[model samples]
Target: MCTYLHGPRQGGMYYFRRGIPAPLRSIIGKREFLISLGVKDREQAKRMIPQYTTETQAILDAAASHGPDTAPSPMRAAADFALWQNKQEAAEYQYQHSMEQEEAAIAREPLVSALEQKLKLSVDKLSPEEQAAKDIIDNLKFELKLSQEKRMPERAGGERPENSSNAKGQLKQSGAAGPVSSAQTSISAMYEGYATQPGLREATVRQFRSIINHLINFLGHDIANQVSSDDLIRWRQFLQKEAAVKGKPRSAQTINNSYLAAASVTFDYGFNERLIPKNPVALVGKVRAEKKIRLRSPDFTKAERKAILSASLSIDAGRRSAQLVGALRWVPWLCAYTGARVNEMTQLRREDITKIDDVWAVEITPVAGDVKTDEARLVPIHEHLIEQGFLEYIDACPEGPLFYDPDKSGVGLQRGQYKRVGMRLAEWVRGLGIGQVGDRSLQPNHAWRHTFKTICLEAGIEERAMDYMQGHASRGVGRTYGSNTLPMLQVQLAKFPRFELG
Candidate 1:
């Protein structure tokens, strides 16, 4: 009877289930689509349903409307799903492998001692299964010995011993021996290991790799552990002396945040994984920004805010996609009131808009896109927005994302698409000739977050409430203890003064 859930199968895992529409089933070559949600918990499985439903429904609707010729072929869909499943499984395997490696390192001495004791004590009394396990362990020990002996001669510039007893095969299968030792692991290899950490987005992987590539290019050698503090410092100096982009020299902030931060984080991963002995990059002190750069305000000036808000209302719907126009119309206003990062507004789904006990609210959720804090929060719909027919706008919007069409988003990378929406909006704002300061066009989308904080302070809104509503973590550990309920937020939001856009 469930719409998209079928399970409590053998392992308590749930399956995503949906019947193919009768008309399109023949074209798609399936009666229904069923795939494991891979979650054992019912609530977690249910939370996953909307995304699956949206994606599956999108494909089905396309096939129905455009026919099989225009829509994705069944094979293409199957291939794409297979690729995603493989990536998910690979990520899981990588995490498990990493944990096993760490556990082996920590328990090595005790485990070997215990195994030796066990082998000395009961041999004939053991069950067949236990006896089999003991035999495998014995083979593993022999393989380890052979692997070590094979490497010792190679280190002494002698030929490896030819194994007669399947020692080489066992060593290879058991991963008791590898070509790349921990000390000699390349930076690229370390990145490959680091990048496999679960929940890392495509964009993040690209960024980290880009930064690490710069380091590799500078160093001339790629060994991970061989990187020293002086090497990092020289790279820092090189980056500082040269322009990373355009003709302008890389700023101190850029050097610190992007170059050093990336190196530190990636090397920390390498160090933790035993690929590297230590993180040398961490020893490099923070780069000091120019005084002017350090003092610059990220907030939009009053005139700039007025210009942006005014421009939002007047975007030519004729000139842009309906989704972009809708985003141009409302996202700025949402950010102006809520102090939300622009992607939060752009990723808004129609379902995220709802009334909480008579007060209308917008749910900023990670399910829509990446929330920086990775937690969902509700920002009460500003009275001014409601007055401007925001609810009416919501009523007219289709069932999914209010701003961008996922179909038009190219890769269906939700984070990337939503991020592009914010970027596009910033470009649109720049087109209006606002936020232009010297060579840099100020961060048009981010300005709202800064402006919103200032507005809250001026309106005497409590910092805690502002932090909660804006999806910012509380400053102190003690403040994280309690819940910030909808009613409480709504009451706090009422204190915000509505913008006089006239």
Candidate 2:
């Protein structure tokens, strides 16, 4: 008498519930399939049984044939789930709802008898063709009735489950297909929970997701708890040897900072939640790289500095969009004097440049975009920048961001517009033959930050004041007590010497 129908919950809606086969659950990435029947009427719901059963079986068959090759992409899995759900809903209306002939005939008998009585006609007196059509309709109704009576016995028996909550009402699966234990939990599954943890930013969540996905792909399975420290060491080795051995991209520092860092935090989260016994990633050491002796400092060489500054001054506005031209022209200069990150300058609004107590300063605030420390600081503008018409450019610009147009950037891209400005500027600088340090490419925008801090220290500016201007976190409890006023920052900036572009 089981109908495979569930609910009549608070909303009085019914759903067709079925358990996925245990062997295929890992591949499909779910324990069961729950398709809503979208009806209060038992009869209407019963009519949908055949189509739902057929479609779901086909989906299961497809997954079984493909095996683990069908393991879901974390980025697209939610979207795919929604799309499949929509397909099921659309299929409901599209089904022909064809009835079995014998069942159809039996079901239609009463209606046929009533019609004959009302019209005062007998079937025996009908023409040959009319009689033939009548016979076919009777046979179809008979077959449809028989099919439903067999398929949905609960409807035929005039019975339904008490409610959706009861043990008897729920669809049962094999023992292996029951709730996944923490140790059996896949990294993809754990990530679903980890991704919702508070205080993580959108960019951070995105970065973590990418790292987890990469790990999943490399391991060929999503099980995080089972991954030992040995597995992690191998992953590090693979990343470092990727370029020469596997034809994949290579990085040693990135392997430590990004890859291992992401996995370590994820495992830590799992351990804290008691989802895993312990964090294995914590045991793995960083990837080792051969040391390269640098002839010059990490800062941009003086010739490189002069080339970048002089190129920025000559950047043609006619060749590029106004935002790109603006970023290319002034961001380098801003970074050179303030020691603020490149992104801080690229995200600048015209309003962010203000006169505080008659001294021009830039506000590196989270209100503009992401600040690395999530705190704002006032960076005093240098006299050299003012001399090079920086203030005139600010005044001439429109009301919004100085570097990028917000309107052109699509939804959820507010934080990324300034980032794109930095990217575009880097590409432009590369064209100018700057930012190269031997085999490595120095970050064009960041080179100025290194240059600025070095200049400040050499010019006898106080370290604390330089740190304050650059938005670096105060090192000690004592340093956190006082605020650096605009006058203090301006004094620090005064000592920074002007670049001789010749």
Candidate 3:
């Protein structure tokens, strides 16, 4: 005799087995056997036992109907089993739907492999939400096999209209084309217009060209009339994304400047040439950049000044010939005392210095036709510079620039040596373990100018007088007196105390 069991725990199926075994007694406890009948109450378990036994007996009778010697038909058995399983699954899903609508909404779509690849490409340039929508569309296409089933109507003899259909398709394609680009027109005008500014350095020109190129490439050929305010905004966002992807989002000031340069030039050209009715860039406002001031004082203290001077003189003769040391020592000291720019100091010649009423002054007016800002001014040599051996150094290099580059190759000292000297000085400072402020890695030669201003302010020198000494524009009486004369300027120069390193 065989024991029989049927319950929800057996997946709502009927089963029979001889399970009485001493070793397996713990495996199926009393509670499990009762629960297997789909009944928690003792009364319900007793009542369901007969019904379960009846179902199990029916399953056994059906199995017996298929003779032991007969082979089961695989196709018929599989189809019948699938139909029953699908119906059961549908019932289960219907029962669970009330509790899982939110979860179902978030479920992933079933997209074919090929459709997935194409959808990824199409939505690559869209935002996250748009990409999700595109994914759903791709899944629908795969589920329906829409593309494969799209067929044209058959002609009576199966002949197709070739030329006419091709012509219509071409016309449809041409009608959807984008706008044309204004690259050649705008860029050519910008380059030609600003080619003559005196202050336009080589570096500035390069930056201008770079900004124009970026705009042209991003906008493409049909960019002129097709571009709108929203397009510019999108372009800016794209630039930020590109920078972030490269691990360095450009500074806000840098982005603003680039945008201004490109947009302003293009729109201005368009407006002036009557290519457009008005300037598009005129709508954009200036980007307020953070103010950067080099307040880290480089002026040497009294002791450090002496040490540097001693180091200069004590340098191995083989390292920097004695003549070079003697020539360079007074240069750094003059820089600390007068605060003259390195370029101005390096370019100074003996003839540029003159004595007025026994007071020495340095003339810095542009020689002949070589003015930097197309304006010339005289700079007075400090009395401290004279005391620090400027007079002696002047006697040494009387004809040419005081700080001459021995390497007479390339662009020469006037342009390159100034930067080299600054770098060398920074290295020397670092070697001494003294902390430098504000970009310590690259010593700023311009710090001397700041030192000069600070010292002048500290000494209680009148603002106008100090401005005149520094060769800056002055106001009021100082402006009217306009002491362009050497003697009059000499009187004003006498007021500035000679600078001392200590």
Report lDDT (CA) for all predictions. 0.67, 0.65, 0.45
**Full candidate order by lDDT, most accurate first:** 1, 2, 3
User: For candidate 1, lDDT tens digit of each residue in 239-353?
Assistant: 8888544456776766665567667667756644545433455335556677664345788888888888898888888868899899999999999989998878988999999
Put the candidates in TM-score order, highest first: 1, 2, 3
- Selected candidate, larger lDDT, 1 vs 3: 1
Please write out the lDDT profile of model 3 over residues 34-108, one tens digit for every residue. Answer: 213334344554554565445333323333444322333332122122222222232221221111111111121
For candidate 1, the 10 contiguous residues with the lowest summed lDDT are 164-173
What are the RMSD figures for all models against the true structure?
A: 26.6, 25.0, 32.9
Looking at model 3, residue 39 earns an lDDT score of 41
- What's the TM-score of every candidate structure? 0.60, 0.60, 0.48
Give model 1's TM-score versus the native structure: 0.60
Measured by C-alpha RMSD in angstroms, how accurate is candidate 1?
26.6
Clash pairs detected, candidate 3: 179-222, 180-221, 180-222, 180-223, 181-221, 181-222, 302-502, 384-498
Residues 163-245 of candidate 2 have per-residue lDDT tens digits of 11111122222232232243355676667677798865555566667668777666655556557666776787777767621
Assess the local accuracy of residue 85 in candidate 3 as a C-alpha lDDT between 0 and 100: 28
